[model samples]
Target chain A: MTSSTSSSPPSSSSSHSPSPSFPPKSHTPATTAAGFIKAIESGSKHLLIKRFTLRYPEQKLKFVGDGYQFDPKRAVGIAGLRGRHILYHDKCTGCQLCAITCEGIAEAIGMVRVDEQWKHNKKAIMPQIDYGKCVFCGLCVDACPFYALFMTNDYELASFTKEHLIYTPAQLAIKPKYSGDVEIKIDDHGASHHG
Target chain B: MADLEDRISESQKMGMQIVKESDDDRLMTLSVGPQHPGSGHFRFIVKLDGDYIVHCDPDPGYVHRGEEKMTEYRNFIQNIPHLERPVIHDSTNITYSYSLAVEELTGIEVPRRGQFIRAIASELNRQVYTLYWLAIYGIFLGHSTMFMWPTGDRELFIDLLEALTGARVTHAFNIPGGVRNDVPDGFKDRCLRQITYYEKRLKEYEDIFYNNPLVRQRTEGVGILTKEDAIRLGVTGSVLRASGVPYDIRKAEPYDVYNEIDFKVQYMKTADSFARAYVPFLDMRESCHILRQLLDKMPEAGEVRAKLQANPRGPPGEAYRRVESGRGALGYYIISDGTPKPYRVKISVGSFRNMLALPHLLVGAKMGDMPVIYWALNYWPVEADR
Candidate 1:
């Protein structure tokens, strides 16, 4: 196993003395001019490289799939952003599992009675999430046993008022329109966001 | 005039010297409180005489959320989000230790593939945290270019993590039994590409930062904590390694698939600020190597997480598990009373242990070298407070 010892110049002669714990070796500090020139050379090299900033609100990152989904049969979540919650009206049994799971964590999810009638959801109740309270832990998504609750890729949840932050069952069901396609592209010049 | 004379005499008796009259009392007590950008939510009282620091008293806990006490309320699965908050950049490793402890308490064995994925995530997180620390270290030393490069480079890993675990910083990926999800499609190819480019970027760091004469002059011989003193002070992680201890928890304990992956513990003999700063860079390089090995050795397909009951209760017992994180050894000690929630959860962080050496190193050092000495310790204030 290779090990390094004393890559810097010693402060005193006594500190330079040999110890069995480590090899006694020191490197002479480089000439000041050479070091400055090297620093300048390194700094100047980045001049030609492209800027790596992603112009957010204009350019956004692309996701692998529609959103994060969990299969009850498989008992595992698919990888995606832990953003706003999406509820499937047909799939939800109004079991309150998502609400129950979120109670301990964020307390963001609450079952609200809905007007729409679905065969699976006899109680006509679905989770209405308050973005203000949600920590976006995605445990609610994990708690749903019937493929009803999942998180979407749309994370732009900012609202003018606290009242506006709460997404009703219908609002949660309506798929958010987010079309971000920018991804990091590495080239000879540098890495930067590109479509 | 009589009252003023009496006040002056009283102040003098209380060790307070009059500014103009007492040239002998040049010593100044400066509070490097939470307001200071260099301190990072931590305050310290440093007694300075001229440019040299005579005494230092570190006052931590500005960002104290009582993480240990909070764990008693939340169930094992529920605590994942908040527990990862202390070291959010290195969230994977923090939770890795917690998950390891919980797994031991609950008596669950992670599958082979899950172990490989967990190790990969931990290594990636180590890079993320080190890069963040390196960026701050660079800025503290007045190298803006050093700051920009690592921060930009860190996004490559953050993006990779975003793909793998959903969220970027708060992964919440490592549960008690195993990881939350398997690596996404094209994750391997994407990870390989980013890591390859990242390795090339490491050379630039050496040129602009480490090899710079100004940085070397400022940090090289400053805040020297000797090997014996380091051990006596109970320092861990890069600080200990910089002191030539070479005791990495990954190498020593070899949790998960770490023993299978062949790598060396990166350390330096010179226990100065330069070595403390340099060792993390070396460890970052080694993390890249470990990542490569983990990605290579991972099995084709297997269950990522063991499906447990909704509220999985642990038997009456205690489990302590430690993992090698970005700063150092991060361990979680958990006591279960055959309940869904842990009775007492204690987090032993490397940052806290490393901070023990701070007073020792800062004393007799230049006040000008404060930032150099402090940041080089790799002590995260929030982690220490937690």
Candidate 2:
């Protein structure tokens, strides 16, 4: 429409006093056919690269350490996934710290008295979390000074009934069967989600 | 005249006066309803004169979860998860400003290393959110490849975040004291490598999406907002930057370790959809540079979290602070009455501010340019509704 169309972008960068920084831009507009062809070329280039998707259930992602657990003295987590809660019956004192911390946030954890008792747990009460409302934030794990509650990489907590979704004190005591050992590897060619 | 009653009520609710005119014969109204694929968690009404949009009205509050009011019920620390829920994908920065304001009120000093870690998480989250936005922009423009690449590239940062913060998107990582935890071992090396690879991928995005002649023709001269209108209308983030104003909250008002790290704010003189689209791509590149500098300048070892009481409280006062998020300037205003719970918490987000310019840009534009202009403003529906 105007004679200034060809050279305006670059020339204006120098003359514009307010904006000192300008991103490098390609002003030349390729033909409509070429633009479509170039987009196709870039899309096809990815066909040579490996797919990033993980086949869920068949191929679960591997996590490091023994899931997310807190180190009371260190005041930091060991670094792992925030999955289903794992209640350690031996270490639990029935303190209800986890339940107290989760009261406002999710209200997922409830203290239930177990039939069997341990010296550490005088109250015989342990936290039974309802996964239906649990956000898996791992705040409860952080609040547990006694290391009674921790999170494991058992994300498959789906159930048909709401009752089935609630993991009991006895159920939380069981260690989950999660055998995952995959990591995303970046190399010279490109990044790949690898096992 | 009964049929005209609905139109009048709608116009009055929108704060616009309706005048009965013969122009109605030439125009038809269309709603980009909440159920439409193009409008995700958002809806708007647009009147069309055949090929051209004559008037536009944005309807925002479909997903309002009363985030501000809910903050009053929960304590300052318990509210972290709730605060980031609005913009879950870009949680780090949402919580960043909140934490900064809370820290100031309590008179808590974040450790040097903690500040650096917080900045690193912020820069990484920026990439994650921008890439997600770019993906949506691509699909909106009928560029399918643009959608796939950015979505895949986003996993790189998400994986890094998973290792450090334990969760991928809703990282409740930034606490009032500092960050929740330090960067895990091998984090710097992995972050740098992925960022460099991402920089290479950015050029490919230009070739396929930005520089393509079809994309250029559709966007280059469309949705023009001059410098005066951009300022007068009070738009924030990339939309404001695209309109020839270099007003980036990061540069204009530095927060945390942003003052220490060196980077340039990307801006364009042309206030078109293309300029708006290109600004975020350039900002992503700048973020990569900032991330590297932060990792290099980071301290070797220190406490990432401050030793605050179970429920930290502040003296009776108010603190307002803002930070540059993926969209634009995100600020939090918290008034504490020397209690564990905040007296009042108000979140001033970028999406709602940018939405102010939507109607101005949409009117008199061709119907086909709707998606190009709407998304180019970098408006997130949920963020605006919250």
Best-fitting candidate, scored by TM-score: 2
Report the C-alpha lDDT of model 1 over A70-186, residue by residue, as the tens digit.
866668888898888888888889999888887777888899999999887889998999999998879888888888888899999888899999999899888988898999987
Best by lDDT: 1
DockQ for candidate 1, please give it: 0.32
TM-score of chain B of each: 0.94, 0.95
Residue-by-residue lDDT tens digits, candidate 1, B269-304: 888999999989988988888888889999989898
In model 2 chain A, the worst 10-residue window by lDDT is: A1-10
Give the alpha carbon lDDT tens digit for every residue of B1-386 in model 2: 88789889987997764656755577787889687769778888898889999888888889999999999999988898888988998999999999999999999999888999989999899999999999999999998888988998898788888887888889878888887766767888888888888888887888788867778877888999987787778787888778877666666567887877777778888888989999998899889899989999999998877888888998999999989999988999999999999999999999998998989999989999999999888988999988
True contacts kept of each: 0.43, 0.35
Supply candidate 1's per-residue lDDT for B71: 94
Instruction: State the local distance difference test value for candidate 1.
Output: 0.85
The global C-alpha lDDT for each of the candidates, from Candidate 1 onward, is 0.85, 0.84
